[model samples]
Target: MQLVLEKRAERSGTIALVSPLLAIGLTIVTMVILFAILGKNPLLALHAYFIAPLTDGYSLQEIAVKATPLVMIAIGLSLCYLANAWNIGAEGQFLIGAVAGSWIAVRTQGTDAGAWVLPAMLVLAAAAGALYALIPAICKVKFGASEILTSLMLVYVADLFLDYLVRGPWRDPHGFNFPTTAEFDPVATVPLLIEGGRLHLGSIIALLVVAAAAILLARTIKGFEIRVVGAAPRAARFGGFNANQLIILTFAVSGALAGLAGIIEVAGPVGHLQPGISPGYGFTAIIVAFLGRLNPVGILIAGLFLALTFIGGEQAQIAMKIPLDVTKVFQGILLFYVLACDSLILYRFKLVSSNRQVPRGAG
Candidate 1:
């Protein structure tokens, strides 16, 4: 007998909505087993992973701070996925954005630059990200290159470029050889939302992005085209939708959001450009996008949920001596189960006879 996954005639709407929750359940079960094997109390570990982080004001604000970039980046990724454009280089785009924006901050440091500096940095970062993302899109359109491969490959290029900049030209002379640019000027910084609090303007911007994305996907002709292109290419062609154009458009938009997130992270939370400005936020946002099922509102929720894991992981490391990498493992497991559960929802396994008479002239 041979087993195969056959597409369901019609997916259950209820199952579709429940798939993410089920995936989370499965991931938690897996983590419990892992904790037991690690000689930790599974129940206590679970509490540390989920409950402890939400019990304090500071941790709540930190979650929001971390969620800001995740939501922004994931929203962009959702657009790419909805348009059937595979952009796997958002990390590269994020780094490149941070680098582009920091160019303004670095140049204007200690200068009497006015309020325009921050806005200019954001605009430049977004533009640079969009342009960088277009490279893979254009290559895919003109040369038939695989976007997944080209985009993923570009990440390394961006990483190395940023590393070179920080360690070479942009290094802060007074930072005791640290590979970083100097702190951004007040004019170039993201404003705090509350005095002496972790929350900043970036979180507000992230929420604005979520709202705008919701509007774009729910109320616009372009949104209709993206859905059509991804769901039914033949129908899209009949409807006069250009698949190539949509791919380029989605990638550009995706890159632009990633760039904006990068700049916000640097100017808001991080206060400077550096080699590790992102702790894999671009890569992690992919998980958030999928976990949220590619919806804007869902992405916001998923981003916050994942942000909790980051905080919980740190607390686990300090309180329980749990390895920090366990958080990555949890995320990886969650993503794996998410895909598996989604597959089960959209498909069914069938067993059939392997041997069959071949048609005449069939090889």
Candidate 2:
């Protein structure tokens, strides 16, 4: 038997709208089968993953906090993806931003810095992120390099640089030999939304980013250009849109958001620069961006849902002895199903007998 993807005559609007949902449903089914294979209760595992995280206010607040970075990064990624600019190294951008912002905090560790410290950190982080992201973009434009490979290779470079900093120059003097900078000063930290809750100003910032993206896409010429360049390259050229320029612009914007997210994360929850500042947020945001269908509002919703997975995955680990690696596997499976279902929107599988003979005079 031979299976082939036959293009649809017309795209299905209903399927386009329901693709993510169908992917999610299929993921749940797959997870259930896997749970049984591992000698676990599928119902209990699902409860841990989906229901336990929503049973309390604290967890709900934590979800928003976690979603903050995911949403911000995914929003920027959405822009790049919309413009046909693939930025696979957002994780590196995020790290670079954190490193840049933390430079401000580390330099002013014990100073009587004024109210300017935090804002400066945020600005510097965004700028650094944008600059780092431009490397691959520039290479792609100048030498026709593959942005995917260039960007991805840069992630390890950023990761190694960050690790070196934390372990060597920035190691906390009295941190019991741990690879981390001293905790960020109170003035450099993101203020808590509640007096003692896990929620912080970063979540509010994420909301603002979403709003800004929505306006940009719906109410601006650049947004139209990006949309056209990605959706119809030939038409974009005829309409005088510059795909190359958009590639650079989208990458810079995406990197800026990822960088901002990195700083917010360090300043808000973690409160210090460390070797493992991220839990693969950059790569996961790819899933979020696509899962959201590259829309601002949709990304916000998708971000929260993915955040729930992080929290739920932890809960399952503690409750049922499930490996934390399972979460990554779950995310991988989800991304796979999402792409698979989306493909069905434009093309569908057809099976043919392998023994079938070619008709005479076919060609």
lDDT of 1 by residue, 55-110 (tens): 99999999999999999999999999998999989999999999999999999999
- Runs with alpha carbons beyond 4 Å of true place in candidate 2: 1-4, 349-363
Query: For all candidates, what are the clash counts?
Result: 0, 0
Q: Global lDDT of each model?
A: 0.94, 0.94
Over the stretch 271-313, how does candidate 2's per-residue lDDT look in tens digits?
9999888999999999999999999999999999999999999
Identify the candidate with maximal TM-score: 2
Give residue 56's error in model 2 in angstroms. 0.5
Over 4 Å off, model 1? 1-6, 349-363
**What TM-score goes with each of the models?**
0.95, 0.96
Q: Candidate 1, TM-score vs. the true structure? A: 0.95
Name the lDDT value of residue 258 in candidate 2: 95
